[model samples]
Target: MAEYSLRAASEARELIVKLHNSCLTHINEVTSSLKEEFEHTLHLESDLGQWLDVLKGRVESPQLNSAHRDFGLSLYAAASGLYRQAFSSSRSSLEVFIATTYLSASEFKRRQWVSGKLDISWSYITSAENGIYSQAFIGEFCPAAQSDRDEFVSLAKATYRRCSEYIHGNVATSQLLPTSIAYDKEIMREWISLSRTTLLVTLHCFMIRYFTELDFGQQRKVEATLEDNLAHLVSVRRILDLPVERSDS
Candidate 1:
């Protein structure tokens, strides 16, 4: 018998456990370096989770649930140095949230989606003409914010393409990844930035889709995140109804 042939299965199991233990230790070692990202990670989780908590019956869907679940998984994957998987999961969650917003406008299309008859086209979702970020969509939902559509359309497109680079394993992305799991602060920081971008884009869609319809209490629940991330946007400022200057009357 070959010296290690019979024990291949056992060796594999041991290797898996060893890798898992190494990831845990790496997580500890990198905590200080990732302070900002870790803080933002916690904040993003809370923003999405709390927003859902307040949505309870208003916007219920298996897709939304799954999207939120995947967002959480992305954070865990990042902590474990599964950077590629982390970005992929984040992109999927972002896609689902945008898709949910798009489908909320039409039950027929939504049913088609649920039945797998219609597809979730990222191009359609971000299209400058008919997408969630389009002036037409915003005009219908919250016309006060129509002027800002192009900005978010750009953001949505850029963030999605950034994640897709990782998902498709372009030459540069492949070269950037490690052969084995190990903490990569540069990539981890980038993931954190992408996570924020994902949240910002998703929240922008939700603001147009659901904000006006939310009861004052519901609006109050998500306002902090909305303000913190998007207060600079003319559209978001309008949605939040921040005070306007009147030159002291």
Candidate 2:
């Protein structure tokens, strides 16, 4: 009985040692992952800074007007880069990492299954859209007031949700969210088309109301309604331009 008890004690010690070793291994892996992330973020920020420096030069070039189209594309890229980092930075939690990885892999598999296309590059679409919106004109029209900036940011968040839904092959014809006023010009092609048509009519009605010289309270109401309704009108216009059919294949 004493020998059997000694044998059990030996086995217990071995298990404890094994557990300690496993814990060490886990700690090392987590440390390595954090280091890698730190280095990656540092490199990303450095690259973004370089892009900003180049943009500053591009902004001052005498031929800027002639190159405005290309300039616009570059600006979008820069903004997208900054946004990518910003978005991913907030997702430092383990759940976010797991969720993003699983979602990305699932989406990739779905794309392959649907189209038989296996070499899809997700970054290309992401970076291209970002580059397009990063232009000089966008900077010129950026809201200066804190309240306006906050509203624009909210709109931007909503627009991003719409874009994500469309990109993910999930949005139904009737479900797309409204486009926000805060979007860069490069992102507004569909809205631009609507603005040239139905949207212009709405704007004309609002302009007449504003310029007609109503009483103070009436003018305030008109102004408030114009501010609130403008985004809705633009979104509706954008909705008109989106394809009605879902492209699963």
Candidate 3:
């Protein structure tokens, strides 16, 4: 049996922090780009920071306006999906892992953690589970013996359960609300910022785990993987620049 090393874990931690910061930066850039068109008075970047301040349970507001609520939820849904795919494990069915671990949840079936209703026509939790496995990438990079791969998959699933519970379940109870128009703007910005940051951290861990599977030297691999993941994150930001679209028919 192999023991986890502090040095590798530390490197991973640094990378996760960097990823989180990079995500904030990307979100700010995009928000600033759109502020002029939206005729928004508040600087979205600053609004996001303020939102985080409130999320610490410092203050509370009355009901958030529908537009802001919907926008924040939509961003959360998309960001959650992107992060899960890059970093977390596949969470197709709650019971899919319940047999292996002592965990069960009904919310996984109903509140599937995406922005809107989690379906095109079929009932599927595509967002949270999308790109989670990366079977092809894992096979190519983290190649392992059949038994070892199975074990890795199981562990990853377990990790997903833990992380999801923390992020999706716990984070929802945050005491913040959209009070003013500025508050609403801040809410959207903050959600976007946090989502990107979380995703970056996740990718950082995933890449380090990837290198470990290949028995590669940790220090060099960590640096290389962080850089690659950052670039990928930038590309993802561009792809999501379009306005949020949903239907109520």
- Residue pairs with backbone overlap in model 3: 77-114, 77-115
- Please give, for residues 164-240, the per-residue lDDT of candidate 3 as tens digits: 55346345523333221122344344434433333333343233233343323333434443443343343222322
State how far residue 64 of model 3 sits from its true place (Å): 32
Tell me how candidate 3 scores on lDDT. Answer: 0.35
The candidate, 2 or 3, that scores higher on TM-score is 3
Task: In model 2, state the lDDT of residue 151.
Answer: 38
Show the colliding residue pairs in model 2.
75-134, 76-130, 76-131, 76-132, 76-133, 76-134, 77-130, 77-131
lDDT by residue (tens digit), candidate 1, 1-249: 676876997899999999899779767756778876788778877787767776668444677888888888988888888888898999899999899878888888988898899987999877878888777888888787787787777777888899899989899988898888887878888888888888877777777888888898998989997888778876677667886544465
Kindly report which residue stretches of model 3 are placed more than 4 angstroms away from their true locations once superposed.
1-183, 215-225, 228-249
lDDT of each: 0.82, 0.32, 0.35
Report model 3's TM-score to 2 decimal places: 0.24
Best by lDDT: 1
Model 1: C-alpha RMSD to truth? 2.7
**Better candidate by lDDT, 2 or 3:** 3
Q: How many residue pairs clash in each candidate?
A: 0, 8, 2
> Candidate 1 — worst ten consecutive residues by lDDT sum?
240-249
